[model samples]
Target: MQNFLKKLRFDDVPILDKASLYELLNQRFADEEKKLSQIPNPSLLHDAPKAAKKIADAIREGKKITLVGDYDVDGISSTAIMIDFFRQIPYPLEAIIPNRFSDGYGVSPNLLKRVNADLIITVDNGITAIEAAQVCKERGIELIITDHHTPLDTLPEAYAIVNPKLSTCSYPFQEICGAQVAWLLLGLLKKELNLNIDMREFLDILCIAIIADIMPLVDINRTLVKEGLKVLMSSQRPSSLIIKDFLNKSSITSEDIAFQIAPRINSAGRLEDASISLEFLTAASTNQAYKQFEKLNSLNERRREWEAETTNEAIKLVNSDDTIIVVAKEDWHEGVVGIVAARLVEHFSKPAIVLSINNGIAKGSARSIGNVNIYELIKQNGHLLTKFGGHKMAAGLGLDEQDIDAFRIAINESASKLNSDDFKSLDEVIGILPSSEIDIELLNLLESFEPYGEANSRPLFLIKDAQILETKTFGKESSHSKVTLRQFAHEKKSIELIQFKRVLDIPSEKKLTCSYRVVKNEFNSRVSAQLIINKTYNY
Candidate 1:
């Protein structure tokens, strides 16, 4: 018999029955009521009200307002939210998304030298743009910085700065994404100017940023995503509709945004300029949006090809005995290294860093598994790094090519001293349910906890002693399997289970235990519950 580990249990959370599980989940996972009202006053965020007033003054003075944004999903969404808001007020606003290759991550000196504006407002970035802030000051352009990244020791001397992570800020939730921070500032701006604007219209963009940036979906984020998903489903937004149609999704979910939409949007910034994605998000016409979507789709295909090629090369550099994996190669695409690092972590279950070498300089992205603080590890070796910044689980850095080997050794040594428990495989099973209990009703009930991501995840269930009646292989590469499963004791009731990217061999006589999730499969105007098998053990 295959050993089945009961990894997670809600014994501490009081639950009388299946009907009460929702309440239990809410009690345990949700920190506060997920309502718009639950969001704290925007003024509580450091300089948010000041930023709003600055923006209002700039509008009144008829100053040219330029928006500088980063080139990621969060940054693009933040820009889109601001553009959508400004459209209501009839302002001549110019938006710029810095090219990853040309202007680097944020508002750089290169960008400031070209921009001609009386006022510059940076969204999703600027918290780390110390030199750029100086450049803006020198150019006599009033600056407003709104971002969500962790601030450094000394903040930039901008006209007004809005970031919840600031030590002086009193916002209850500090984990919000960049778009949410921008949305909050816009909300304050709307109230200050008494502008008749429906702020809820921008929630869809906020939802995309929150999920795409991998923010923990709890507290206000949960509420925003919950309501945002509804708006997205009913939204006539040209880009949203085009993307939905492109993916052939009948209903939008958090997973759909994370897996389908975010990747395509990110591909533009990754392989090319992010303006394509920003244009797609803010496209006013269906034709324009569709054209942008097709372009992004093509870019995503190219990204996939590069990602696969780089991942293979990265894996070859990994040693079986290494606790931390660091690989560098000249001519590797800088944009795809982050994805390559993620794939390395997933495949090896270790913290990994992938660097692209150019002109004796190495630029790298790092990803961590378990509780490893990859950022801290990189920071500890700051002497060897030219630049580095990121959160605990992920980071980006630059270093001299000669320092790559030394940095790798130092990071691996640091990782080795950490707890071995961090490296252990942990199953994230929520609970077990009998095959008979799996139905559309249960799926609906479970979906009440919608907008799942990061901290708030979709539930995985274990089904034991299921008999496999039939199996078939599908997909273009014949790498997918469709198996009909039923309880051993209850043979009449069968469930169709789908497994992606993995071909399984199930003997006709052998019973299996499976870990799966219940998902609604829609086809030809009909919806039915289906099991998505994550893993299976035969006994």
Candidate 2:
């Protein structure tokens, strides 16, 4: 492990030695520091300031405000953030999240009709909700959209639009997700009102959303997480106590948020009720928050079971003929299908569509690999879909059962029209390594690449031929295997590298090449390093 990473570093790969690199990272971090100063953030377009003024006026006048949030964690967190911020002002506000089972995604026309509010703010979603916005317009309810999805050719006719992707908009970073948009709005509000509130308080919540939403952790996002983690570690955030008690970690990292907290936040919507997560995030007392946190933990465990089983079943249905992977199961829960689709795309190195069939209408989530654009692919075959919306890499759609075959052919056909080789050619498989390289210092450098998700992926290193020295299996059912490898490739240096979850499939006496990440493990009051295997091949 020690010699492996150094051997893997390439000339073209970015080095920290350059002044520009440090300058850029510093500037980006500074920009994040001063984010709150830019109230009525200049990045947003089309009456964002006007909408902020309206919201501020509503607060002063004590008018009722209803928040319409989407179904995902980003939406829920955005909802919770709004609720938390407003409650600080102690403003009169009510939050309404659309149900995935009942109201479906986006701001539902029915949901809007039922709510009585002078001002309605939509988070994580609403830019594409043309008809629903019209309903709000007709009912004399002012609508403000603070979404971060790709805009349509024609935007919704609403009171204000605040998406970064709009061509007319001047937002510097267009790639931010919806939760970030909500954070930006909050930043603007804090600045305009001359509020003395700590900016880092909101950033702690934002760190979770940033990681949970799988947005790129580059530029502004990198800074948000960098400073957000500071606030979290300092335990200064007033709103993160629920999350604090839930994990019970002495120190919080972005990885903790992504793997531990975000999933729990998301589990509510996936397994049962989204409101459980909202309640947990906004819980006032430690006891109340702990209860909700425990519930979310239970829901997350169940969600994992469902995801693992559903993905295994879906993989069996994938045919070798299709350029893309399309699999559906009627029994699959609609909420977790997106996650399953993402897993399939990652495992198979192909675009994947996981669908949940209900009432002859197949609701599906699509995830892509590399440069493949699932949204554009769906758009090209627009006639086959009842409705679809998303960015290039991900999308959601509804299709009729009768059109399944044609839909498959059309998507595959569209994929075939492009360079199929382009998708797989980028995939590189590397060798096994000596374990000594996985030291605390390198781990620190790798750890610096925090808040990893989506575009900013975790560092993956490759190692060449190492011989397996020992093998063992763990877990109640022996479901996981761990292997130790030995290598003395670099002269008088021999090291041990552990390959986890590979003992069952791998033979003990064999030479293998592997790719992995270095993770530090503390046991028996001692610290050592381990290699988390990514891909391996036996020789």
Candidate 3:
């Protein structure tokens, strides 16, 4: 655990003099507030108004409408938002989420064949559904696509398409997630149809999608999450309330969604059909929501089991000399490969792809580190792949079983050409703090930067030369450590520090330098400042 200190990079946040702390705080808050105030209008999104008008026309004409969504948290949340909005307008609508195994991803021809509707709207997917869009066109089904994925050179021929990343799109913020795009569409529809629906009702779930999809929490995203957290804690939504109860959490935070709620929602899609998650989010009553929550919770547990098994097997296949880790096995669960790939990336600090071999085809998930664009790398070897799509950090692909070795060799060669700095581990430190400065007042000031995620990460500070007063190990496996420390100038003031999944061997007589983040630990209705240790240097 202590070895992590050697990889630390304290360059991101310069150490500021104590006298300038207040000025720095004020400047950051002012900058964030200014960015929030300049959020762009949804009207700026290309084809948004056109899509809204088409949707309104279908509802007015009583044309049968079906929503086609992906099998992920973002897609499920997008489907729920649209379903809730349609219910308010008293419009009968049908929703369908693709099954990861049968339906593959996005709007497939098989999925489209199963649906019979005059108008088909796709959320969170359809940006790359060229053939599926052709099928819809031939079948005379009107298609309106609302997605946020990176677009290819030629877009599908749909009735209307709304995506911020479109080459023609002038929307100022292109990094918004799928659910936010759905929310924006609903905002326009509410106005075009003169509906009196409160858009804020959807933020609680929208916030989850934004964070779960790893969208940057800045500008409009920051506002959505900040406001969404308030709505989530109010417990007005049955789904949110049930999730909170299941997790035994008194209040919801960005961390809660990232680690707890999102995984449960995603588990359904990963293990079976994602429609279970959609049902959970859109359940009409508390009892129904609870039932769905229980089902999702069970699925999540199974997912964890499969993920652990696959991760161990994949790790065994990693070669130390390889620039990229590519592992494949027969009978491995396809649903858990993505999680396994991510774990490999974390453990090996390199790009990794885990494939599940079934019959003669290999379906895999790839995860990247630092500057490596996994999507671009996979696309570069497109000749060997049957299907591939995703962003820079992560991607999914399929290929012939025979090509696995060649594909692995190709990606590793590409990865080897990159600089070593791209694969180095660097811990971003905010600033240095003395024990005297560790108090509730400083923690409260840090709270101003709420809803931390991708871009706006939680602040981390380095505390130098702190003497350990006490130490203890806990948890089922005794893998967690709790310690009390004090600085030289403030020997009387001791602070509690916690390190999860790591058991530290520190002597009370020695002083250590620690990098940590300030967090508020709540217990029995009381909250206090606590330090979450990320790395410790024995000096």
Best candidate according to TM-score = 1
Q: Rank candidates, lDDT, best first.
A: 3, 1, 2
What C-alpha lDDT does candidate 1 achieve relative to the native structure?
0.83
lDDT: worst 10-residue window of model 2: 425-434
Off by over 4 Å in 2: 1-46, 236-239, 242-251, 420-434, 489-503, 507-509, 523-526
Clashing residue pairs in all predictions, respectively, total 0, 12, 0
lDDT by residue for model 2 over 317-368, one digit each (tens)? 9886787888877768888899999888877778899889887889989988
Candidates, ranked, TM-score: 1, 3, 2
Model 3 spans > 4 angstroms off: 1-38, 244-251, 417-427, 463-470, 485-494, 505-514, 535-539
Model 1: residue 135 alpha-carbon error in angstroms: 1.8
Residues 230-279 of candidate 1: C-alpha lDDT, one tens digit per residue: 78877899987786677676668898899889999999999999999999
Error of 2 at 435 (Å): 3.4
Cα lDDT of model 3 by residue, 1-539, tens digit: 43554435433445555445556545544454534336677889999999999998888888999999988899999999999999999899899999999989989898987999999999999998999999998999999999988777778999989999898999998988889998998999999899999888888899999999988777788888888877887756889788767656555678779988899999999999998999999998989999998999899999998998888888998877788888999979988999899889878788899999999899989988877778888888888899887887778889999999999899888877778777754336667776677777776676766776776667778767677778899997898999887856636777788998789877565676788887777777787787898777654
Give the alpha-carbon lDDT of every model: 0.83, 0.73, 0.84
TM-score of 3: 0.90
User: What ranges in model 1 sit over 4 Å off?
Assistant: 1-24, 30-32, 247-250, 421-427, 463-469, 486-492, 505-514, 536-539
lDDT at position 296, candidate 3? 91
